[model samples]
Target chain A: MPQEASPHIVRSYEGELRRLREMIARMGGLAERQVADSAQALIRRDTDLAAEVVRRDAELDQMEREVEQFCVRLLALRQPMAADLRLIIAAMKISSDLERIGDYARNGAKRAIVVAQQSLISSLNGFERMSELVQENLRSAIDALVEEDAEKADEVWRSDEPIDGIYNGIFRELLTFMMEDPRNITAATHLLFIAKNMERIGDHATNIAERVHFVVRGEQVTADRPKGDDSASAVAGAPR
Target chain B: MPQEASPHIVRSYEGELRRLREMIARMGGLAERQVADSAQALIRRDTDLAAEVVRRDAELDQMEREVEQFCVRLLALRQPMAADLRLIIAAMKISSDLERIGDYARNGAKRAIVVAQQSLISSLNGFERMSELVQENLRSAIDALVEEDAEKADEVWRSDEPIDGIYNGIFRELLTFMMEDPRNITAATHLLFIAKNMERIGDHATNIAERVHFVVRGEQVTADRPKGDDSASAVAGAPR
Candidate 1:
């Protein structure tokens, strides 16, 4: 039988867990900022800020590698059981989600730079609202993970309907712009992709929320997530 | 100190590892078929096949859950060290990648249904070719994981450039189509997204290959994988 761990070992293990949470918190913070900055860059047509968002994506990639290395080390050395093991696994998965979130922001920023070059065709209000909602959900999801609050995570999970609703509106409006004038095609296409990227960012936030819920409750979220994005099968053509 | 494992425990542990590989192989086969079928459905304008692809995505999701639960159980019971531990971690990560690939296929299938309703605007030959390449890469990546062949994984990692190359061509071609006629706008837009979905599925295949490389070599593919997708920064205006 294994002997009881000394107080020193126990304290050190606790510190390591605290450090893991801090790492995730820091990573989540960077990802959230990336999403916000990318949207601001698009709405403001600030290519400089967009370039910054693109440049900062490398940091998130590096952070994910670091988090995975740290988790693997914890698993090997600490041999954590029960909740700690679950938390470590959750950290690895969340880091992957956050990295993907960063990639979407970066891709949006890249397109934002391209969009800045084209004449504006449609109101960007929908993009702004969509971005804000996605950012809020991402922030709440991260907070839920750090705080170990399943209810907060559940709220974020249930709240993605509004983001999808905004995305649907944007999809139709952008298509209309393209149909009205061919000149709008380039700008509208990039904007449509940016809007889609924002919607995907929201989905990643929901994925993070689900992971957090699992960590806190030690069970999967059984309820079917409410989905509102119906633009997938949408069809539109030039007015007859 | 723990006693040396008996023959039966040793044999059972090895059997468990074999079972894990088989599970991954099965899941990977299903994902590859989904990609192929979705592409074929679009090219053939077969809405029935597209709907079937959409319906089958749930199986990949369930498989991902099963893979994770099994990996967690192994981690807890086996406390596997070194290569065994890395393999389990890789399995979890790869399953997530596969699940996302399934989602892309399903999304593409949904868009294909809409595209089928509109008159075909351009040759879907590019789509068929792109889908074939992506399916090949996904298959090779999974085979690398099961066979523990780092070189095969590297080949898949390095081969994604052509998929992105084709996607860039499709992106510009669709924009040109939209600019040519207002009626083509709707179908072209949906085709643009389907092409993008295929590109993303290819990217996920590269991700799986990278994970396999890590599992085999115990280190990441350090040198940057070549990237050819420049559509994010592409800009095109209506021909003056």
Candidate 2:
């Protein structure tokens, strides 16, 4: 009799895990769209679309909160071990990153709204290309996660380096525009925020890839891209 | 026969959990010192010091990996329940945030190195103050986490608003400097990066606060003031 009851509890635990997976996928899809729309609004200078992007970020945040709550509750109640516990925790971390990505998109969209109104906004200079890359990277990272595909995750991680180069190019171009004339400052600042948002989206994509690696092999793959040095002590003697 | 050994396994699992706690505390201390040093580097423009900061970042990243691995191993072996599972997951997340915070400091110090060559580059307003606030918030948030104090976590959350405001102020100032003169672009770019890094540190601190709330109360807390609601429709539109 006791054995039967314990198995029933385990089965219910499995049910909760399934539900959690569904919630994460839902959140991922919405987050991906927010990035796409935010980019489209910027290129098109459609304030209405940008405003919409801003509004949707709140729901992403709320959904993320809900999913995290569900996962933690399941862990507390069921006491999943090994792969199951890892799955729930990975979901929590992944959702948090996605929510932040949504926030970035909304922030970019807000800037797009302001820049769209200006009379002298400069050319975005391959920004649309960069935005598309970011969107694709994000979409694929989530796909890799759900499928537990390590190759796809690695691809997503590699995608971030190129995205960073593009961001640097964009940054320099914007700096030049602002230097050329004062009228460019406002729109340029907004554009810069959008670019930063795109770069951050890339970062989140990398985070998802790392999570995918963790889920698949039960080992951390973040060690692949090694940071150069500590650079911690360099702060004290530098000019403030 | 089995009854005699059950208590031993339980006891060993508890010991492993305690060890995790100690590791988390050590990681927290390392991260807090990084923040402090980054601020000092910003104030001093010390290139050597900045280099050290960058060096320390890798160590923190390594520590993060180790912490994550330990958490995984524990989860796999112990199948802990309720508060114990919550604690482990929180530790995993908190260490990730700590590593990222270390990154922010390294990035900041790198910028300080670039700015070190320039003559007295601190003209950008609000950065020094933002740095101090971020550093203080990080210290307090880590303290709260180590001590398991919810009220401290709340204070960290509330403090993020002011940090955001200061970051905005720094952004605007840097934009003005770049707008005013073409020659300042390179150095100002470094300064802008420094500002972004500080803002990121603030974000990391907020993340810790959220984890603390999740660990202690099994509920989610808003890490910052809520933005626009339009994010709702956007979030709702995605396929679940």
Across all candidates, what is each one's fraction of true contacts kept? 0.73, 0.26
lDDT of 1 at A98: 96
Q: Residue A112 error for model 1, in Å?
A: 0.4
lDDT of each: 0.93, 0.75
Clashes in model 1: which pairs?
none
Q: Report residue B239 deviation for candidate 1 (angstroms).
A: 11
Residues A37-80, candidate 2: write the lDDT tens digits. 99889888898999898888989989987986798677656767
Give stretches of model 1 more than 4 Å off. Answer: A1-4, A237-240, B1-4, B237-240
Which candidate comes out best when scored by lDDT? 1
Per-residue error (Å), model 1, residue A219: 0.8
CAPRI grade, predicted model 1: high
